[model samples]
Target: MQEQKRPQFKVFNTPELLETILLHLDNRTLLVSAQRVCQTWTVLVQTSPAIQEALFFQSQEHKWHAESISSPIYNPLLVQAFRPFFPSVHEYPPIHNNTNENATEFQAEAEHHGRDEDSHFSFKALDMLSSPQKKTAYMRKEASWRKMLLRQPPVYGGVTIFKMHHNMGGDSCRSYEVQEETPQANQENKESDDDHKMLKMGHFFTAFIHNEDLYFGRFGHTRIYWSTYVPPYESDLDGRAGGSYPPQGGSYSRKVIENFAREIVRSEVVAFSREVTQCCVGGKTNLTQEESLRKEILEAESDDRV
Candidate 1:
């Protein structure tokens, strides 16, 4: 009986079996914990195409046919990490966070949502935006986000940027939406005779990482203000505020910057900003003529802030 002892079979030691097991894990766990288990697990996580797509490092090409209203999931890590920059109505209530006008309403709504200010997700978002000290670390060349997609389905339409301007009279928004023209259109204009092209998500990432100042717009009760500058954007159709964003004179020209900004404000306007901009002034969805003008200005301004 003493000589009858048998060797133990280790299931995880098998790479094929282990990869199958790991494929079941959520993205956060794979990145945070499983990858650290051992070198084998790490390699599997990094090399597995399915796992890579799950982490949003690679596009889910097969899922393209299945794309529905919510078929493709938003990159959860990006949603959490860049939460402030990508505001949401369900997550961040449309409230004047920096003001006290709707204190009671905002408090009640926040409580209803069970908003946990101390949560790690909230902390990360706040820390990224408010803490300049950590920017250097995040800006590293090897940062995980450098290769990550902004959206899991991958934004093939390209990225749009908006800049919002703040002022006493009223806020205004401008975008380089006009810059994303087709080759035929570009040929027709001929004004933009260079190799200037539309900015993509990768371009946004490059610009964001290199930039020192973080420019975001606040959708207040009645207005959208790009907190970068205290002045209004240039009124000219192609004019841009010096040192505003999308950075002028390089791959992203003034025209490209303008068009991108416009696209973000209209199509991808922050949910929190949109709701607050609509309801904050009077808590009314119906806008008066004056309020309507303010909303219009705010929408335009929202793009600049992007």
Candidate 2:
């Protein structure tokens, strides 16, 4: 009886065996586990293009689980160490070398804008705009939004609205048009384009001082006619107010535009995930493991087709 202990049989080996083991596992958990197993497993999981594709496919099938996963463990200290040499977001424009008089004036302006007042802008209006049911509910609650122009005193300045033309470059320009909508027009347009067209909403109006006076307009609306004067800035198109604008001529850099685009993409992804979770979970039977597995397989096959 004392000599009855036998050797433990090892089972995992070969690509086929590994793939089989991975098939039943949740994608994100598998990825995390693979990453922690050993240097060999990490290299296999990370470097193998096939495995990477499979992981994404599996993850997409069970995306609701993403909410439960831990935040990505990135090395912040390492990131900081290299940040100066490899800046993630572009650097802010250099401060102008100025006399004390100008510096004081700049500081005052910065303090006024730097306060968290910008955070009040809400994207709820845009969300309502996107959903027919919500739009109806919103209209029932607030029948009409009054439009008013608040006049600055004569000593401060006045405001003006102008129609700006967009240059679409080449023959494609003919397809682009700007149509201002009244409430009735907006409803009509929504109904007409319900099946075909996608609406592009501009970020909320933001006021910027240009030539020692304040000017405000929706960010994307400002782009209806491109101007050398209006510098680019990151903005949430759905928000009630436009985001902060960089210094004059500061936004001409490609990096600035790319960062803005990335923010938009991130927002889009969040919106998409929320939509999926709401529709999938609320409308029918909860997604089953078998169905999720089938979806992962189909997605993986689709990747091969691509």
Best by lDDT: 1
Per-residue alpha-carbon lDDT of candidate 2 for residues 62-126, written as tens digits (9 for 90 to 100): 33255553222112221222222112111222223334444344334444565222221122223
Task: Report the C-alpha displacement of residue 101, candidate 1, in angstroms.
Answer: 29
Predicted structure 1: clash tally = 26
lDDT of 1 at 305: 45
Candidate 2 deviant stretches above 4 angstroms: 1-9, 47-49, 56-306
Q: Write the per-residue lDDT of candidate 1 for residues 1-306, one digit (tens) a residue.
A: 533443223557667777777878887898769988888888888998888878877776557657643333557776666654344322433332333334344434434654423221122343333454444445444567656765545644333334443444334454432233356657766544332232233344444323222232233221112221111123332233233222221112445345444443344321111111233345434544434433433343344346
Residue 140 miss distance in model 2 (angstroms) = 47
lDDT of each: 0.44, 0.29
